[model samples]
Target: MNTLFTVSVRRISHVCTLKPYKETKWLMPYGNPTGIYVYNCVANQRVPVILSDPHIATWYSCGPTVYDSAHIGHASCYVKLDIIQRILKSFFNVNLVTAMGITDIDDKIIKRGLETNTHFTNIAKQYESEFWLDMNSLNIEKPLIITRVSEQIDCIASFVKKLIDSELAYVSKTGSVYFDTSKFPSYGKLSRMQDEGEPSDEEKKNKMDFAVWKGHKPGEPYWDVPWGSGRPGWHIECSAMVSKVFGSQLDFHAGGIDLRFPHHENEEAQSCAYHNSRQWANYWIHVGHLQVKGDTKMSKSLKNTISIPELLKTYSADTFRMACLTSNYRYSMEYTDAAMENAEEVLNKFKFFLKDAIVYINNNTATHPCQYKDSILKELQKVQDGNIEALKTDFDTATCINNMLNLISSTNKIIKNDSSGYYPVTVTLIVEYITGVLTKFGLKLQDGSQENIFSDMLIDTLVEFRHTVRLNALSKKDKELLNACDIVRDKMKSIKVQINDSNKTPSWVLIK
Candidate 1:
C-alpha cells in the first residue's frame, strides 16, 4: 500500500516545512483561460481559457506505464499539475484533489513479461516500484488515490454499458466495444479536431476506433465484463476511474500536451457519452513537453530519456524542483546540463543567504525595533497579493517564481547593508515572510552550525591535516582562515547569519 499525507490548515507550521512548494492565497484559481490562448495539444488549436465553477474543482492525470522508469518529461507534467493544484487550493479555497492513475495493464507490460518470462503482475510491480521511487525522489506528493486499469474492470464495464444503452457505443463483430464517434456531434471539441479536419477513413475502420472495451487478446490481461471478456482501452480506463472516484463532473483535467490527441480527446468523448451532458471539466490544462537536447521530445521510445532515479543520485531534489519552476508550465523547455547548472547555482546562493540570515538572528544583541517593520510587511503583502493576481491570469508560474526570487534578492541585499539599525522591525517582518513562503515551497533554512566555533574547527582541521604549510597569506591569521574556509564551505553556511545580523563588521561572511 502507498502512504498518504494530508495537510490541514491548522497545521500551518508543519505545512511550512514542506520543500519550497505551497499553495498561497495569491495563487491562481480554477477558471477559464483569462487572456492569451495557450497551445492546446488536444484541440490542436489555441482556445481561450475559461474557468467554470470553483467550488467543485477536481483533477485527473494519466500516470506512468509501470513498465519503465520515469523520465524528465514525466516530471515536467507532474510539476505543472502540482502547480495547478496549488493555485486551485490557494486561490479558490476549494478542496482540490488530484487522482493520478497508473497504467499497470497494457501491451507494454505484456511485452516485458514475455521478454523476461515473468508473471505480468510481477513485471508491473517492479516498474511501478521504480516509478514510485523516482517520483518520491523528485519531492512530488502522491495523488489522492491511484487507480489501476486492471483493478477497475467492473467500473469500466458499467460505464461502457451506459454508452451502449445510450446507443453511443457499439460492440463490433470483433467483440470489442467501441464508441461511435459519428454519434457524438461534438466529437473533437476538446481538441478542436473537427474544426481543423475530420479523421480519415482508415482512422475509423479499426474496431479499437477509440476502444472502450477490448475483447480478449492473446497474452494480455483480461477481466469479465457485460460486453465480453476484454480489457479497457487507454482512454476509457480514465473516464471510468474518474466516474468511479469523483463521478462525471471534474474541476480540471491535466496531462502532457502529447496526450491531447486520441488519448484525452477520446476520454472526453466517451465520458460525455456516458453522461450525455455538455460539462465535463471546468478547466482543461495541458502542460508543455520537456525537450531533450536539440528540441526532441524526451521519450523512452526514442531512446533519449533521463530517468528520475539516475537524476536524483546526482542532483538534489530541490535542484529538480528549481529547474521545473524556472520555466513556465505552459511553455516547452529543453532540459540540458546548462539549465540544471544554473538552477543549482541559484539554489546554492539562496541557501547561503538563508544560513547567513539564521546566524545574524542568533548573534544579534540589540533589541531595538525594526525601522521598516511596516514597510517590510507591506512589501511581503505586495508579493503575496501580486503573485496571486499573476497566477489568476493563466497560472503564470514564471512571473510568480520570479517575484519570489526578486524578493529573496532584495532581502539579501538589505541584510548585507544594515547601516541604520532602525529598520529592525522591517527586517524581522521580511525575514519571517520569506521563511514562510520558502517553507511552502519545501525549502528550509538549515541551521545548527556554530559560526565562530565551526570557523575555529575548520581552521584547525584544514591547516593541521593538509600539508600545504606556509601558504601565501595576505591578511591576518583569522581573516586568512576565514577566506580559506569560505572557499571550502562555498558561502552556504555563512550567508545564514548575514540575513539576521546587519550590525556585524563588514568582512568575509564566509565566501561568495
Candidate 2:
C-alpha cells in the first residue's frame, strides 16, 4: 500500500496516508475526461477528479464566523454542500472525511462584543451554540473535525513564522506580519485577479498583499506570538487548520462563490507557499449566491436577511432542502415564498404516492408467476441506472429528481390500466427505490411521527379484536357487534389510519 506523509504545525497532531485509487462501476464519460467531472475555478474548465484513495476522500468547507446568527444565505451554502456530500457517499460509494473551521476570534466578533457590552469569547460561544442548533434542525451531518481559530493560535503563528523565514512574508514596523504577494508569482491564480493598482490603506507595502497577523489593539483579544501580541488573520486561520487536519493537500475545498476572491485565493497562496506544493486542494467547488425575491442580495446591512430559525417556524426543513436542490448548485437561486410552497406541494405528492404503494403491498397477496413481474423489474433497473448516470455528471440532482418524477408517473399509469393489481415484488421494488432516493436527499415521508413496537402491538390487538367481533356478529346477526366494528373504523380513521377489508387478512396503513 502507498503511504502519504502528514504535516503538523505546532501543538496539534494529525495522521495522513496516501492510498491508490480504486475503480468503480459508476464511472462515466463526460466533460472531455472520464469519471466524475466538475468545473474547476482555477483551471477555467471542467476537469475530471480521480480520488487518490477510493475509500477515503478529504473535504474542507469554510464554516461560519460565529459572531452573529446564521441567515438564509448561509443555509443555502451549507445545505447545498450537504447534498453534494450525501451524493458522494451514496451514489459514488466513497468515505468522506470532511472538516470545517470556525472563526471564533475575528474583527466582527470583537465589534459585536463591543456593541453588546459583552466579552468577545462569551459572544462567540453563544452564537456557535446557536449555529449548531440550526444545523441540527436542518439535519446536516456534523463535520468529522471542527477546528476553532482560537484553539489553533499556536499552529497559526508557527505557520506565519515559516513564511517569514522563507522570505514569503515580512514583519511590519507595528510588529504585525503580512504575506508578500510578490514573492508568490501565482498569488492571484485562483481568483484570476490582477495585482492591486494602489494601496487603499498605508499599513502595508503593497495593495494586493494581505495581513497574516494583526498588531495588538487596545481592547481586542490578543495571543502572544513571535511576531507580536496579536491574533491570526482570517485567511491564515483556515490555512493553519487545514494543514493541521488534512496536511499539505486536500481532495476538495468548498465555499460560497463570494469566497472565490480574497479569502480562498489568499488561502491557496499561503498553503502552497508553506508546503512547497503547486496545488493546495485538487478540486475547488463553490455554491452560487442566494438572492431575495426582489433581486436583492441577502445581507445584514440591507436588513433583509432571514434567519434560519425564523424560516423554520414557517417551513419544514425538508421543504427548504428541496427548494435548494431544485436549482443547479453552480447557479444563483432566488428564495421566494412561492418556491418553498411549491416544494412543499411536491413533497406532499411523494408522501401520498409512497403511502398508497405501501398500502397496496400490505393489502394484496403476491401472485405466483405474475404476468407483469419481469417487465416491472426491468423498468426499475432502467430508472435506477438513469438516476446514477445523471448524478455522475457534476451531481445533477435536478435531473435525478426529474427522473424520479417520471418513474412515479409511469408507475401510476401502469397501476391504473392493469386488470390485476401490482405484484408484491413490483410494489416492494418501487417503494424501496423511491425511499432510497429520498433518504439520499435527506428527506422523509412522515411528518416526524414514528410508531413504536408497543404501538404496533396495540394496533394489532385492536384489529384482531375487531375482526373477532365482526365474525361473531356475522354468525349471530347481532346489531351490537356490528356497531362495535363501526366504532373501531371511526377511531382508526380519526388517527389517519386506513384499513382495507377487501382481503382475507386485514392490513392497515397510516397516512400522513
Candidate 3:
C-alpha cells in the first residue's frame, strides 16, 4: 500500500508539468534518447527526470546560512550536485536553471553577529565571500539565480499574506504568522514522521503548525508585514524565493539529507498549499552527510566539522572531490586521513597513467603502428560505455570511479607487456577521452603532482636534476635509483616551459 501511494504521488508529480526529453534535434523527437533518472527521496525510488519543457529544467538548492566557513559536509553536497549538474547540461543536453539561497537572515547569523560584535549582514557577507572562494576552488558552477533571504523579505511577506487570506495560515496574537499544518493532510508524507494531535501553544491552532512569519522580538531583525512587523520564518524563506523565481512547480528541490525532516517537509507543505497543487516539486534530491568519527556528522554545533579551506590546505580540490565521490551520493561518507590519502593515491594513478601514455605517443617516431588497434579500441569502448552506464543508474559515480581505476589497471597491462610497435597516437586518443570525462566530472587535471607548493622553475629544477642523474643511474643499473628518478620526473611540471623532449625533458627557457 505504501509503495502504491508513493508511485501514485510520483506519477502525479510529473503530470503537474508538461513535456519531456528527446532523442535528437530537441524540437522534433528522433531516435530514442536515454532518459535521465534520479533517485527521488520522496518517491523512495529511482524515477525518470521530468520537466515541463523537454529542453529546460529547474532546480533550487538550499544553500548555507553564511554564518561561518563552509565545511566538508557542505562540499560533499554541493560538489556532488555540481558534477550531476554538469552531466545533465553537457551529456544529457538539458538546459538546467539552478538557484541557491544564501540564508543571510537566519537566527544563527543573528547569534553569530551579536557574539562577534558584527551586524548580521556583515557577517553574512564575510562568510559568503569565503563560501564563493570555496565553491570556485571546488569548481562548482554558479547558480543561475542567487536569492538572499534578507533581500526577499517583501516577497516572503506577500506569500504569507496570500496564505493567511486563503485560511491555510493564521496570524497569532503575538503578531507571528504560522502555517496551519492541519489544513495540509499530506504534511508528513515526505518525512514519514507519525502524525501528531498534541495540544498547541496559545499561538498555534495545532501543535504541528509551523511558523511562516516570526513576530518582532528584541535583538532580532524585522520587516513590515500585513500581520504586524515581523520576519519571514525559516521554512518560508525557500518557498517564497523559489516560487517568486520559478513559479508553481519545480523539476527538482535539493539539499543535504538532514534537511528531509522539519526543514524540507515544512517547505514542501507550504509550497504545496500556496500553489494550490498536490505536488509542488517533482523530485527531492537529498545528499548524504559527510561524517567523521564513525557516523558522527560534521556540523557546526558538533564542533567536529572540517572546514573547506583547511582541507584544501593539505589536499588538492580534485583529491577532496574524489573522496566525496568515493561513495554513492545517497550514502554517508566518512572523512579520515586514510580516506584522503587513498584519494590522493587514486588521483596519482590516473595522472601517471596518462603521462606514460603521452610519453609513449611522443617517442614512437621510429616504431611501426601499434599491432593491436582492435584490442585497444575494445578497451576504449569499455571506458566509454562504462562511464555512460554508471551515470545512467542514478548518477552512480561510485561505480564509475571504480570502473575508471579498473580500466587504468587493465590498460597498463597492454602498455607494459605488449612488445609489438603501435602508433603512439593510438593511446593519445585514450588520454584525451579520459581527460574529457574528467572535465565532465568537474575535475581539474594537470601533469605531475597537482600540488602548487613549489614554483614553476622548481619543476624545471627537478626534471633537470633527475635528467642529469639519469645517465649515472643507467650505468649503475640501480632499479631503486631509476624508480626514484621516474618519481621525480612525474612530480615535475612547468606550464611556461614548452617541454616536448622525445626523452620527456623541458626544452624551452624559463619565463622568469
Candidate 4:
C-alpha cells in the first residue's frame, strides 16, 4: 500500500473474543486505533485483521521469477515481511504456516537460456540457488513450504481445467487458455480497473482477459497437458500453488505493493472461481517498494537495481535491516548512503551499550545487587510493552524501534552514574530485553565466544596495570603507593578477583 494513504469510512468485522480493541486516531498513515488493522489494497481501507479460528493462520507469499539476481527491492519486500511475521508470532501469538512459490519456468528464464545456449531448467536452477542464498544472507526466515512452477505444471493444469469446466475460462483457438473475465461478475473488483476500451487481442474475447496457459511456441519448453503443450501463466501459478498447499481457504496473502494490480487481482479472481468462495484470502498484505536515492522503483528493466549481495558486501545485515526499520513497511523508502550511515550509527549505539553493560556486569558485579532500590527494571518492562503496542497497530516498526532506543539511553545513564540500580538482576534483565529485540529484527549480535575474548582482553589490561602499581609499592615501602594498591584491591573484590598482599609479591586469581 505504498501509494495508499487513502481514507476509509467503512468499518470491518474484527470483533475477536480473545482480544478487545480500543479506538485510536488515524492521524498518521500508520497511526493508532492500532488493534491489528491491516491495510487491504482491495478495499482501499485499513481493515481490521480477523482470523476465524484465531489459533493457526495460513499464509502464502509470491516469490521471484528467479531469472537473475534478487535485488535490494526484492530484499526490502521479503525482509520487511519477515519482520511483520515475527511481530505476528510474538505479539499476537498467531501460529502461521506460510508458503511461497518460486517462478522457475518463465519467459525471462527461457530467454536467458536461449541467449546463453543453455538449457532452461539449468538456468532456472542456477538463479534459484542464488535466490535462496540471498534470502539466507539477509536472514529472512524460510517459508514453511516452497512450490516451484516447473514442478507444479500438472497441478496448474488441473486448476485451469476446472475453471474451463465452470465456463469461467476458455480454450483459445491456438489451444492456449484464457480467463473469461466477461463471465465472472466480480472480475475487476480487486483492482477496480475500468475498461478503457482498448482493442482486444486476436486470441482474447475481451481486452481484460489474460492468459492462464500460454500455448507452446518454437524453442520453448512445454508439458503435454490435456489443453496444450505449454507452461502456466504467471498469475495462475500462485492461485494453483495456494490451492495445492492450503486447499480452498487461506488466512493471508502477501506480496510487494507493485503486485496489487493485475498480478494479485488476477490471482484473487481465479482462486475465487476455483474455490467457489467470495473470499480467496481473508487478509491481503503488501509491503512498499525500495527506491534508489528516492527516485523511481528499482528494477532490472531500468538498470537501477542494487543486488542484495552487492549491498551486503559494503554493509552488515543489521545495517540494511535497521535502515528498513527506520521507515514503516507500507511506505516506499529511499536507499541512500546517508540513510545507511544513520542506520549504522543507531545499530552501534545499542550494540556498544550492550557490550559495555555485559562487561560491567561481569567485572563489577557483587554477590548481591546495589544496596539501594532502583526502578530501572520497571522502565525496561514498559519499553517492551510499548513495542508490542506499536507492532499491533500494523507493525509500526519506526515507533517500536524508537521505544527500544529510548530505554537503552535511560538505562545507560543509570548504569554510568553507578546509581541505585540492581546491577545483578536489573542489568541482566536489560541485556535479555535488548537481545530479544535485536534477534527479533534479525540483527546479528556478537557471538558468546567473541564476547568472552573481548572480556578477557579487558581483564588482561587491568591486571597488568595493577601488577605494575603493586611492584612499585612493595619495593619502595611507600604508604601512599600502598593505599593506591588497596583502592585497586577493593575494585577487584567486586568482580571476585582475590589478591593476596601478605607476601613480598602480591598474587591475584580471577574467579571463574
TM-score of each: 0.74, 0.80, 0.81, 0.79
Compose the digit string of candidate 4's lDDT tens values, residues 40-108. 665567766656556567889999998898999999899998988887776677888989999999999
- Scored against the true structure, residue 511 in model 3 reaches a CA lDDT of 43
Candidate 1 global CA lDDT score: 0.63
Better of 1 and 4 by lDDT: 4
Candidate 1 lands at a TM-score of 0.74
Candidate 2 error regions (>4 Å)? 1-34, 365-369, 373-375, 417-421, 451-512
Relative to the true structure, how large is the alpha-carbon lDDT of every model? 0.63, 0.76, 0.74, 0.76
Q: What is the lDDT of residue 39 in candidate 3?
A: 73
lDDT per residue, candidate 2, 1-512, as tens digits?
11111111121212222111121011211112225768777656665666666667899999999999999899988999999999988777779999999999998999999999999999999999999999988888889999999888889999999999999999888878889887776677777676768876677777889999998989888988876788898999999999999998788899999898899999988998899866677788999988986678887878989999999999999898888878899878888888889888877767777766655545434333132355666777788898887777788888877777777777766555556555543544576667778778876455767531123544554465456556767789988657756755765665556666632677778886
Give the worst 10-residue stretch by lDDT in candidate 1.
18-27
Residue 262's lDDT within candidate 2 is 92
**Between candidates 1 and 2, the TM-score winner:** 2
Tens digits of lDDT, candidate 3, 282-312:
7788899988889899888989888888988
Candidate 3 residue 511 C-alpha distance from true site, Å: 32
Q: Model 2, 207: alpha-carbon shift in Å?
A: 1.8
